[model samples]
Target: MKRLALILTLLSAPAVAQDAGLAARDAAEALEAASILLDTAEDSRDRVAALTDTVRAFEDGLAAMRDGLRDAAIRETELTRKLAAQDAEVAQLLGALSALGSRAEPQTLLHPQGPLGTARSGMLVAAVTPGLAAKAAALRSDLEEVTALRELQQSAAKTLEDGLAGVQRARTDLSQAIADRTDLPKRFTEDPIRTQILISATETLNGFASGLSQITENEVAEVMPPIEDRKGILQLPVRGVIIRQAGQADAAGVTRPGIVMATRPSALVTTPTAATIRYNGPLLDYGLVSILEPQGDLLFVLAGLDAVFGEIGDVLPAGSPVGLMGGDGGDIVSLTSEGGGAGRSETLYIEVREGGTPVDPLTWFTTE
Candidate 1:
């Protein structure tokens, strides 16, 4: 009976730990890949894109590490509780084994029921001894795993620190590369006088959008490939979750003719399709904004950015980084947060205008 209890003590661990172990290994591999990316970023022909990739790699790795750590914490807590609960039974098993070994010779072994009982007791002990050894081996493995998990958590702190630093460096490099970039095609140079006059005259977004063509430096009418066929399938300019639909009011009871998306701080904001930059600066109530014209008479308005990329007249290809969301993005405490990026999110406001009329952005981009 004691032997059975001993085996039970070592056998109740859930299969959850195996998943955590796999996650930890995968996180380590991802971190290694990010490190390699950082090392090779400087040599890439397109430093902006390379650095962006590096930063994304680091973010993915850190997120995985956070998940693994959370799982390890939960598993360790369960193990501690289980082992503590079985302490009394384990002690009883040890006591019984001790009594069986106290007698040096088999002939000297005695039972209250005389020789027959003694023989039966010896036979039972012999039958169960190998099973006890196997259970003891399993208990040792569990204890070792617990120790390893603790060590992994401690070591991950440094990895988290390095990942944070590496990603920041990559982001900085990307920003600099964008600033120094000058190879993009120009649809039309922006005239400052026209832009300021238009802003001063317009009272609303619709009015401002209507006057976009008037700000052109030289109105030769540059023709570009049409994206009318790409409607309802365009990717979002940034990776985010839609928080508010078009015309939805906020806590302040103010509503706008645009959709709001919540995204992680410092996340890269890209153009969903090939577009010409009609404007890229602060406008009226909107913070920093990027106005893109994907086709004639159609405009995409992106607002609330910390940094803007590309010049006013530059025509950008698809997936080009337009700017970055606002935030420090270096929250060390969130390194072990289960879902990762526990920091507050920055919001991006997006609006689609067709022939100067505001329409639901979901008409072009799906939330999924």
Candidate 2:
């Protein structure tokens, strides 16, 4: 009886040990599952944050574009009123000229005199004719200005329409990008304190450029494709005619090395190559400028934009939308050669630099 009791106790002990082993295995699996869930939650949170930032950026860009459109509309209305006034003035001038022509014969008859008087009258006519010619020339110049202004107004309207469409497209793309949640590798995170300091400290282009140069000194170099091999093969950032090429003197006699393109108002600007944006904002006389670096020692500067998109340090693929030209106001006097036609035109200045030396962009882009 004692032996049977001892055997029963051993059997119960083995059963109890087996149960403990099973419980330990279950706890280990549960802990691993919990850890996995925690990791997944953290990943999801990071993704959500990235998506939010992207959406916010898109919203800001859309707002800027809309603001530009509104400003253009206001400019258009003002130009229309000025054009109407100019038309009335031109008509009044024409009427006055007609009256003068009609009275010429009578005035000559009423002044009955001899050969000496006739010679005096001829001299008077010569002086008066020159004055009339000057007035006519002035009228023609005014008419040309009116025509050009009207063309700009029309182009602004077209640009507004195109901008609306572009905004909608960008919205859709932003939504899609968020949904996809693509995990793009980060190049470098911006130091908020440093960026703020740079923003507040730099007032001029040279100052801002100096700050950027300093910032880049500490950045890890990124591998990029060779840009030197693509000379004359790159597409123009904006579609237009090269009205002014590098080294050409502008009306101001400022012979800065760059290409000035006469583009349709509100024309969309695009990236010419895969590049990282270094600077994007108003600088000096260049209305909104964007600086892109495609590879080592190569920088592309695009100026005269109305609105710019993408933040500094953003890596963009080739042909990505960069910004839009605000086609509202123009230096009509400077644009006489190009804007004298029926179409409205805006100017864009592009410059390429290698190792701080300006290079002709015509050699890199397909201007035709």
Candidate 3:
């Protein structure tokens, strides 16, 4: 009877173990499916955000163009007034010269032959010649003023035209971005209240920087690829030459731990890698600035933009357009040591930080 009981227990144990194993496998499969769904949702949310940024960028571009046009018009009006004044002066001088020319013959003015000729020549030398010389000088000055005014007007007009073209390009790009993401599902929406707070907060950069350090981000279980793996492989956010490198001292004698790039007017700025926008607005003396977080404990600071696209918390993919550099409208002047000046339309400042410590960005980008 004891032997029979032992055999029955062994058979029951095998059946129970098999049932547990099957249940564990089913649970694992369910968990995997849920993870996949979560990933898909995040992807769709990012797409919608990117599309929204594109639309906002287009709107901003149009507004900028309008502002530029208005400025151009004002400048042109001023130039026109100056030119008109110069034209009147030139006309007056020409009229005086014409009257003098009509009264005297060239031969009599140049060489007198008799007593009447000698008297006329004395009169010409005493009064007419001096007046002519003065009028000619005035005419030359007026002509120079007119020429300068014309050049200024032409430059203003060209700037306005370029701004219009930029707006149209922005519109087309916005449309394309919208179409590309139309099929995506949205899992996240922007919080207007939070965004307003960020925009309206008139705090110093140090204050904002401190606040940023305290904000916690939602954790995703998936591991992010390390930035270290992409050393010397990443492209620059903008196409330009690096004018200032990290740890260089500026004119102010303060050491700067970022890179400064010289770019063309209205050049587009993009993300070098996938990142979440930490902040986007004016910060201190940097003008329009953008702060991005690409991975844990890493942040990128981009500054000196005229217009920015994404809001805080917006996720952008690698190489996604974020904003454009402010154009000089052919009016910017940078003084040099030679007592001359050059046009520097835009300057982009880039700073990288790892755990709040500044790091050299040249090690990460393929600047060539």
Collision count for each candidate, in order = 0, 0, 0
Q: Write the per-residue lDDT of candidate 3 for residues 110-148, one digit (tens) a residue.
A: 544777877777786667668777868655654444444
- Which number leads on lDDT? 1
Q: List the residue pairs that clash in candidate 2.
A: none
Candidate 1 vs candidate 2: which has greater lDDT? 1
Cα lDDT of model 2 by residue, 23-89, tens digit: 2223223323333333343345554333333333332333333333333334435545765777866
Give the better candidate number (1 or 3) by lDDT: 1
Report the alpha-carbon TM-score of model 1 versus the true structure. 0.78
Worst 10-residue lDDT window, candidate 2: 329-338
TM-score of each: 0.78, 0.47, 0.46
Model 2 stretches with alpha carbons more than 4 Å out: 1-186, 190-211, 216-218, 328-342
Question: What C-alpha lDDT, on a 0 to 100 scale, does residue 299 get in candidate 2?
Answer: 85
Q: Candidate 3 at residue 340, lDDT?
A: 18
Candidate 1 residues lying further than 4 Å off, grouped into runs, are 1-18, 81-109, 116-141, 200-203, 246-249, 253-257, 333-344, 366-368
Candidate 3 versus truth, CA RMSD in Å, comes to 27.2
Report the C-alpha lDDT of model 1 over 1-368, residue by residue, as the tens digit. Answer: 22222223223333445455455557666877888898998899988778777877877776666666667777777777877887886787677667666444766556789989999977887788777667666667767667666655565555667777777888888889888877787878888998999989988888888888899876557577887787899988876667788999999999988998887778788889989998999888889999998888889999999989998888888888899899977764343343322443788999999888888998998656
lDDT score for residue 151 of model 1: 59
